[model samples]
Target: MSESVIGQVATTATSQARADVIDGFLGTTRRYTTSSAEGLKQAWDECDLIISHLALGATTRLIAGLLVNKKTDPGVVVVDEAGRFVVPLVGGHVGGANELARKVAEGLGATAVLTTATDALGLPGLDTLGWDTSGDLAGVTRAVIDQRPVALVREHPWPLPALPSNVTEPGVERVERRGTHVKVLPPPADPQARILLSDSTAVPDDLPTVVLHPKSLVIGMGCNRGTSVAALRELLDATLGVHGLAKSSIGVLTSVDAKADEEGLIELAAELGVDFVTYPAAELAEYQVPNPSAHAEDAVGTSSVSEASVLAHGAGLIVEKTKTPEATIAIGRTEPRGRLAIVGLGPGAADLLTPRARKVLSESAVVIGYRPYVAQIRSILRPGTEIVSTGMGTEDMRTALAIEKAREGRNVAIVCG
Candidate 1:
């Protein structure tokens, strides 16, 4: 390993040892003293990172030492003497140990090994390791925490050999393998790890890690004071689908003024198998689009319908409109993507103006509405906001443009005359 190719081996070896290892591995690297422990300790403290040769005795012991003993937080890793295995000894997730392991394995011509369920089970990575005393992690119907063979229902990466039935459970559809160590998703080409399972539902309770399916989130919403649930749901759906998401991802529902108690929204959520959540009109009001219409006596607040979306994003829940034949079921925020806010700028000019609507327009990235409507905020367009001006046209064209902009994950303003 020439110093240049190996990038000058860094370590804390009385300066002499550091030079020795650099020269040894570089020029004529040699170990005159039989001090593996001393060298390793120095390597541990000297260089910022230490590389382990694959499941070899030294690497295994190093992993055990780091995890069981919690020595210095070195980036311990195992690679074959031939540069195979390349397993991250510690800090596999945030620290990039998992990624390093792959590189080492690749350097040694070994297969990359991953143990996460999403990778092992062959699903897109969306696992989590969290405590939900409220039991509201992510619409979890059935989740086994940090499972070994991950008693899971969904299938992820196909194992080298087919997974054992015991590896996963029947009812355990959602599986999350939790721990201090984070799991990495291998590229599609190389997924060759085994799935492990345990008879006990409880893992040893290490630092927790969780894995889960990438289901779209759903939120059932309820409103009041002449609010129509159907229009709300439609708005949410149209808005959500525009963003290339689905209805099934909803983990929970949200409504205005603690509308969680509202019967129509509640029933609708139950029908969809999602939880109903009602937030304060004030809270949901944060998402409300500014209503220029407020200046008018008839104008209410900014299109709070649009403001509701802020709740979904802030709540970590996607907003879905509940089913309702009466009220406008304008649900569309509950996409795998973020929520959609649709502002119905009230009838005309400065007469109906509200601070809330102004705030939304100010924050919107893509304002979708008639030329005049978007033109109303001549001075407000931020440099980043992409205003999509629908030409003077019919409701169909205007509606279409608003939906398109919202789906594109842009804050949309529907200036209906």
Candidate 2:
């Protein structure tokens, strides 16, 4: 959860109680001030989201002066004095105001006032999918909402919610048969509207075409004990550039356990902002690779370090081992990790629902629950999210189905009342 601030018009007793309720559910830092204008302006500069107990008109007026574009602005949600309605005033999708509004409503037993067309029409927002997206997002999202012909182009078959009939998956055969190795797919021919899902950096840069990068790449490395960080970084940059890979797609940096404390490997992983993983020498030796070094086995007790470590972590090699004077680099594409979250809908009232539970429901790609329970939290779920509901006495069936969906790399949530 990100940091947030709560702004109030005054330090009155009523406002103090309301701020306490907001903080209890939000579970973040909270502040109360008699000065609404100063508090809001300072929150605009310091926080990711703001819950304003002031009047909607007043909050809007104050926000109008501090507004940057949607991408940079913080999410603002206005709670009425009575706490009857939670309204997302600005930055609905980009700043996460709509989702915040839903969570707040659940805590306050209020209604979330959503005005975004995509939410109203039950269509997924392009920017809200949690992927690195580029180009004409607004146009492509509108096409999805209007049921226009939008081509879905993918280099790999990523698990996503069911799209509208108007959105067609182009080159289905190619996408279905795509090999483990990463390759750039050609753009749709004369596409009027397009949404691309791929790990590769190369994609068409035309208007109304949005590119979504999947976190699919893992870099396996091996380095000498005293190797310089500069040398390792240079090799990494050159290798990614030559292969046309996106840095955003790289998810992990891995090596043999012998290099776990190696300064160069640790520093490089920190610079790349990816997790560093190390496998035991015996584990690394178990994996077969194209290049196995007898010298490495004599020195580090493993026949291979760079390529084998990636294979040990259940990834297929996309780029073979490339070496420099002090470091060796190899890249692989790993299957997406499956996630399963078991959530309980607290008591019966919406206000009883926990914030963490609400957040899991919002982020899930698939939600499974009883038919009645599913309906309870349906309003908070993102558009286009898949739902599987069953009758009573179907516990085994629901659990089995949730596991199957998760095994396919889908974020799944099971709800229990």
Candidate 3:
């Protein structure tokens, strides 16, 4: 469970001590004192997870609802006073509630009951949609080995358990994270319910009892086959540098399906706790550039690296395509704030100022461009506003001037030729 969710649980326990349903709320804070703001923030995040774990009070319930909306990964599960039943009100798997349920049950001398189908029917499961912080790895491993069903946490109000009870499972369901497609298929629940995931999406699939919620960014990738871990690290550094993106911004890294089991790729995914996707060769080849990577060309199932890169971009998994190995290390997408609009005005009419253009001009802190262009919007300018203009300026000149003002934290509106 998330620290926030845990704190809510703790708060609930504290407030509901008289209810006797919750054991006394217990926790330790990193804070030496809550009187300080930083200390308070630590206390706040920690208490969130603790309270979420216990689900002990009203405040816990409230916070659980909020975190669900926010998509905090350490999942939430609320249970009855006896701990016999578990209801994953928020993040079910990624949040650690599925695993936490077992721990909580043991702590309470009860069963950490899991309600997801794979668990009920005894099949391999993985919490594909979870916080993926170090803690989730162990639980996911257990589900894989134990043949227990996994519940992916994506949306807040989890759908009811899917597939009718006592249905048959599709033949041979496997729980492998490093697969080409991590999608879920409702292959008719047999006496053994079979739920397999391939093709992961940002939102959860229409499976009963689970949903997927992913972060917003994608990490584009390419690497040498025997790329040493050191090499991978350097790649990550370079990629992050170019994009100006934080590791936290990336949601997943995708490549040709054959690369799924690549040692370095797997290690990288494990290290980052993010998904590593491998797509079909044909699918990957679709985006192949005029030429392709040496390795990608001969890749099994005939996929192209360029396709993978392009697909990642289109899927919004990656903000942009990466061709060079260094591109993998890009910091992130450019968060550019300034923009220029080139208009060919027949009359340069003041009455025709577009709503959007007018809005930009209106909000500009500094309007720097050609003196004539600046003069055209003179009527719209606020009195005493700074409209720095270089007389007799060309479009390029105006663009450069506008960029200068923008770099200095001034909003510049450039109307070019």
Score every model by TM-score. 0.27, 0.74, 0.31
Prediction RMSDs, each to the true structure: 22.2, 7.1, 25.8
Candidate 2 global CA lDDT score: 0.79
Give a tens-digit lDDT track for model 1, residues 63-143: 454343332355555544433344555544433445455554543446767654443443222222111111122222113
Backbone clashes, candidate 3: 69
Cα lDDT tens digits, model 2, 346-409, are: 8856557887887777668778888888888877776657677777787887899789878866
Candidate 3's C-alpha runs over 4 A off are 1-214, 288-291, 301-303, 306-313, 316-417
Tens digit per residue, CA lDDT, model 3, 32-123: 12222333244345543332324336426445333534235345545564456555544455455555555455445555567765455433
- What order do candidates take by lDDT, descending? 2, 3, 1
Q: Give candidate 3's whole-model lDDT.
A: 0.46
How big is the positional error of residue 242 in model 3, measured in Å on the Cα after superposition?
A: 2.5
Model 1 segments beyond 4 Å from truth?
1-50, 53-55, 68-75, 88-98, 107-110, 113-334, 338-417
Give lDDT per model, in order: 0.42, 0.79, 0.46
Candidate 2's C-alpha runs over 4 A off are 1-12, 32-34, 61-73, 171-191, 205-207, 225-231, 261-273, 294-300, 336-417
Query: Between candidates 1 and 3, which one is better according to lDDT?
Result: 3
lDDT of 1: 0.42
